[model samples]
Structure formats: structure tokens, C-alpha cells
Target: MLTTILNLLEVAAWSGIAALGFGILFNIPKSVIFTVFMLGFTAGLIKFSLMYFNVHIVLATFIAVFFVGIICMPVAHKIHHPPVVFCIPPTIPMIPGYFAYETVLSVMNFIFMEDDQAKRVELIDTIFTNGFTMIFILISIAAGISLPMLLLRKDSVKKIEE
Candidate 1:
């Protein structure tokens, strides 16, 4: 139990670091850095919490992204920055890099599956598994993040200096 709490904290911390790096790379303003970091941290916490409760990974990601989107509306309004600016950089940490890499690696292995039927089956199964997982995850992330903005009618906010 205690270990679970620690693990969540660790995920949040590492995710925040990744978010900050992405935000910096994307040229997110300095004032918005902390907000982006917290959003990313919150996303990690939400996903981990859902997974801890035995929710599916894709569902957890969808829920986290949707919640983050809902939260970002008020934040965008309050901070006077475009929701896209705030909403996107934070979600970068959640991209399933491992799955994407696995998808590609499995494809490569499948291509080289010379006469070994077991290896061919294994590689093909892996390719399909990782490929579909990546696709659905990306779809959920985009849809979840976009849902709130679709409902909101406000124009994009311009960056204001503090």
C-alpha cells in the first residue's frame, strides 16, 4: 500500500520533469511552466490512480486527458493563454513511447522472420498488439483533450506578460 503511494509520487515527479522539458521545447512561456508541470503531474496521478483501481490503460488515459481538458478551460481563462498552449505540452509525457517503439521493433522482427513459425507468430502478434495500442492511445488522447475545447466557445487567448 505504502509502496503504491510512493510509486505514484515517483511517476508524478518524473512526468513533471518530462512535461517541463516538452514545454520548454515548445516555447511555452516561463510563467506558464509551473502550470504545465502541475497539469502533467495531475495527469500522471489521475492515470496511476485509475490503473491502481484496475481500470484499463486506454480508459485511464482517456479519463485523465478528459479531466485535464476540463481543468484546463478555467485555467486558460484565468491565465489568459490559449487552451491549446496549456493543454498540449502537459500531455506530452503521457505518450506511450514504449508501445510505439515496440510496434516498430516487432515489425522489423516480423520482416526478418525467416522459417521460424513461432517467431513469425510472436512478432506478428506483437506488432498488431503494440500498433493497435498506440493508435487507440493517440486517438483517446486527442479526443479527450479536444472534448472540452469543443464545448467551450471562447477564442484563443493571447499571452499576457505578468
Candidate 2:
């Protein structure tokens, strides 16, 4: 129980760091900092939970992105500008950088270790498959959130013109 709480705290800390960093960089208002923090916190929770089940990082990224995007949609709507910027900063917690770096290292090791062709092949294959999955998740999140908003804006413009 203690360990779980500690782990949760750690997740919160990292999420806050990511959120605060982006918020400051983008000049988001101090009043909205908590909102960004929570967005990042939820993304971290989703990523960590999926990672616990040994779900591929790509799938995990997708889940985090989709969940955060939906949760922030109403907030985004209220902003009346490029609300996707909010989601982009908040999604930083779901980048899976560690997994990606490890995957790259494993590939490099496999290439240099000339004795085991089979292991090399396996490493390379996992890199491609898992990498593809991760990329797809990131793209899906961006597309899923942005496309609807874009279309809505276009329709509003058409109505104004008419």
C-alpha cells in the first residue's frame, strides 16, 4: 500500500514537471496551470497502468492520447483558439521515451553482437513492430482530436460567409 502511494506520488511529480515546463514555455496563464497538470497527470496514469500489463508502448500511447484528448475537448472548446496546443503540451507525459531508447539500444547491441543472427533478427523485428505501433498511436491521437475541430471551424466559416 505504501509503495503504491509512493509510486503514485512519483507519477504525479513527473506529470507536474512536464505540465509546468510546457505551460511556462507556452505562456499559459498561471490560473490554468492546475488544469494542465491534471491533464498530464491523467496521461501519466494511463501510460503507467498500461505499461504494468506489458501492453505495447504504442498501444499505451494511443490510449493515453485518446483519453486526454477527449477529457480536454470541452476545455479546448472554451479557449476559442488553437486548443490543440493545450493537448500537445499535456501529452508530453505519454511519449514513451524510455521504451523507445531501450528499443534503439537493443537494436544496436544486436547489430554489434555478431554471434547471434536469430536474436538480432528478433530485436530488429520488435523494434519495427513496436516502433510502428508507437508512431500510429501518436498520429491517431493528433488526428482523432484535431480533425473534428478543424471540420467544425470550417463549417462555422461557411455559415458566416452565407
Candidate 3:
């Protein structure tokens, strides 16, 4: 129990830091950096918590990004910035970097390995698996961020214009 909590905290803390760094890199307003951190923390907590309980990574990422979008709407209005400013940074922390790296590594191995059919087959499987997982996770993140904005377009746009 304690270990799970600690793990979640660690993930959240690192996620927040990553988001804050991205926010800084993006040149977002100084006032919004803390909000970005909190959003990242919430996103990491939600995604990893779901994964810990056996949820698929793609679905977990979608749900987490969706919640971040919903939460960012009001904050965007208050800050007079688009919700995307808040949404993008938080979602950055959830990107499947490991899967992408593995995909590349597998491809390299496939290219270098001798004509051992068994190893070739395994490498092909690994490449497709990691590549597909990474692609789907990215798609889910895009959908998650876009869905809320599409659903709340009127309100979000109107509020920003006000």
C-alpha cells in the first residue's frame, strides 16, 4: 500500500516537473506555470493509477488527457489563454517515449541481425508491437485533448472572446 502511494507520488512529481519545463520552453505566461505543474501532476496520477489497476496504457492516456482538457477549460478562461496551452504541457508528460525508443531499437536490431529466421520473426513482432502501441497512445492523446474542446467549443470560444 505504502509503496503504491510512493510510486504514484514519484510519478506525479516527475510529471509535474516535466510539464513545468515544457511550459517554460513554450514561453507560457509565468503566472500559468504552477497551473501547468498541477495539471501534469493530475494527469500522471490519473494515468498511472488506472494502469496500476490493469487498465491499458492507451485508454489510460486518453482518460487522463480528457480530464486534463476538462479541467483546463475553466483555467484557460481565467488566464485568458487557450485551453491548449494548459492541455499540451500536461499531455507531454504522458507521451510513450519508452515505446517509441523500443520501436527504434527493435528496427535497428532487425536490420543488423543475421539471417536467423527465429530471431528475425521475433524482431518483427517486437517492432510492430512497440510501433503500434506508440502510435495508438499518440492518437489517444490527440483525441483526448480534442474531444473536450470540440464538445465545449461554444463555451470555450465565447469565454475566451469575453
User: How well does each candidate superpose onto the true structure, as a TM-score?
Assistant: 0.90, 0.68, 0.93
Give me candidate 1's TM-score against the actual structure.
Answer: 0.90
Count of backbone collisions within predicted model 1: 0
lDDT of 3 by residue, 1-162 (tens): 999999998988899999999989999887888899999998999999999999999999999999997777677777777776767888998889999999999898888754789989999999999999999999999999888768856655445443
Count clashes in each candidate, considering only residues at least 3 apart in sequence or on different chains: 0, 0, 0
Candidate 3 least-lDDT 10 residues: 153-162
Residue pairs that clash (backbone atoms under 3 angstroms), model 1: none
lDDT of each: 0.84, 0.69, 0.87
What's the C-alpha lDDT at position 133 in model 3?
Answer: 96
Residue 41 local lDDT, model 1: 91
Candidate 2 has a TM-score of 0.68
- Report lDDT (Cα) of residue 74, candidate 2: 66
| Candidate with the larger lDDT of 2 and 3 | 3
Per-model root-mean-square deviation over C-alphas? 3.3, 4.5, 2.0
| Deviation (Å) of 136 in candidate 3 | 0.3
Task: Order candidates by TM-score, high to low.
Answer: 3, 1, 2
